[model samples]
Target: MNIVYSSSDSYAPIAGVSIMSLLHNNTDADEINIYMIDNNISDENKKRFENMVDKFGRNIVFIPRPDLNKMSGVDIEVGRWNISTFFRLFLCTILPDNLDRCIYLDCDTVVRHSLREFWETDLEDKIVAAVDDCRSDRYKTELNLPCDSTYTNNGVLLIDLKSWREMNVEKDFLDFIIAHNGNITYVDQGVLNGVLAKKNLVKVIHTKYDAMTVFFDFNFKDLMKVRRPEHHLSEEEYIEAVTDPYIIHYTSCFLSGTRPWNENNNHPFVGDYLKYKSMSPWKDFPQYPDVRKKSKKMMTSVCNAMPKRMMIAGISLVHSKLYPMVRSLKGKRRG
Candidate 1:
């Protein structure tokens, strides 16, 4: 089976972690062809990836290209690189016509189960298949059409290359985006929703495949209300329910700064994230505990160096006065 993943230097850890899990868990496919498209990755990271390839003894297709530096100047308002332009670029330049189908997984996701089932599932002549983002109804509406529209997350997409190319789907998406001038919020994903909605080419898959964790208040109890056994857990319960999840998408939560490696950050799937991270070839790159300690020391030093650090510009005063309250707020936020 062919799988496509895009990697940039900044998010190398996520890509490394994702690749490691796929190689470790997936045994159903005869050949796992990893089409790694690297953009602005460091030489060290590339060497690390090469070491993984050597260890696996499996075929990996490396497609090297110039950096996306040109697009860097373009304002990325909605999704990554704006939805319209990114897809057009990928389909027109990055992908090949020889391969008729492939599974595209976002770097921030972890695949726990074998993807053979997903890869083999019939698309029914559709260009793509994905799961709905159940976190926010408003985001889905802006992306999918009507407010209650079931907007599938583009993080995990099953693409039929033949259909996509034949229908000029990418061009059509770009045309729409050009017409709208990239005003949409969610970029390529938003356009994918709009395009597929118009053609009725998207099939919604099971929720278990792309289980997403949104904000702390993502209504896990509502999940229990669904009669479907697959979707039966409450949000809080779901966080701890590690029954070999197919995919765990750490999407927007990582945006504001709490990473899996941060000691202060308590992720619901920290254990799982660490488990997958450990499997990666680059796992040894950063020692999380050491890094966290170093970061804390630096922050403390910088704060202490300030002239009024402990005086009136008072974070120290706040700490003294509201330390317990701050701790309480943090504790409440933990999943």
Candidate 2:
């Protein structure tokens, strides 16, 4: 199994925990070739990675950053996102031509199960297979996509490199980046969904594959009320995802600076993340003090105090009203 991750020096520790979790859970694989797309990783961090993988009897290969001359003039809205986020867009140029398939995981994820099934999932002519994003239809309209089109989260992509190359996905992605430029909100993620949404080329996988923070934070009814068709997960599936998730993506909490590695993050999966961290080389790394704003902390506390059913009801009502206003605004913009 080939698994890829991209991170810079600052995010290396978090990436190390994610890698540890993957290696620990997927030991059944005959071979696990881990690849890291480097954006100037520090020598010390590299050693840490080497030690972590060495303990598990797996080797990690670091792919140096590729030239981004083509994207020089393209405007990128890199709000809070590392420039390394764009590395996946150029995997075809960075990885060996002979490499035909690979799984890409974000540094903020932890795997709880063997990836043998996910690694061998049939792409069936699709360039990528990924779980749908929780942002729902809002993201489609935000990217000027058709309302019914699927918009996926790029955090956990099963890529078919052969198909990506044959279909010129790299060039198409570059073209989209150049065309949209400053209008992009989620950087490479926006470009990916915008360009791929209309192509019928993305396979929407089950939510258990990438159970995000939102999945645990929100109830099933709340998710259904806001998410699009492609993002739907049955009640049974939702329960299974929370109880026995294949991959737990600390996306929202990571983005919001409330991750398990930080003090007072309070995310439900903090223990899961810490369990892997304690087993990694960076186990003794100091946790950053929780510096969240008082207002945000208060809000989180209030939300946590509410009953799950009440919270879902409140979010559903908001979505019911907000979706119409969003549609109206979009219609006027089109006009």
What is the C-alpha local distance difference test score of each model? 0.61, 0.79
Winning model by lDDT = 2
Q: Each prediction's Cα RMSD?
A: 10.6, 3.4
How do the predictions measure up, each by TM-score? 0.71, 0.87
Q: After superposition, how far is residue 185 of candidate 1 from its true place, in Å?
A: 1.0
lDDT of 1: 0.61
Candidate 2 versus truth, CA RMSD in Å, comes to 3.4
The CA-based lDDT of model 2 is what? Answer: 0.79
Please report how far candidate 2 places residue 43 from its true position, in Å: 0.1
In candidate 1 the C-alpha lDDT for residue 83 amounts to 27
Runs in model 1 deviating more than 4 A are 64-89, 135-149, 215-219, 222-243, 254-257, 287-335
lDDT of 1 at 282: 65
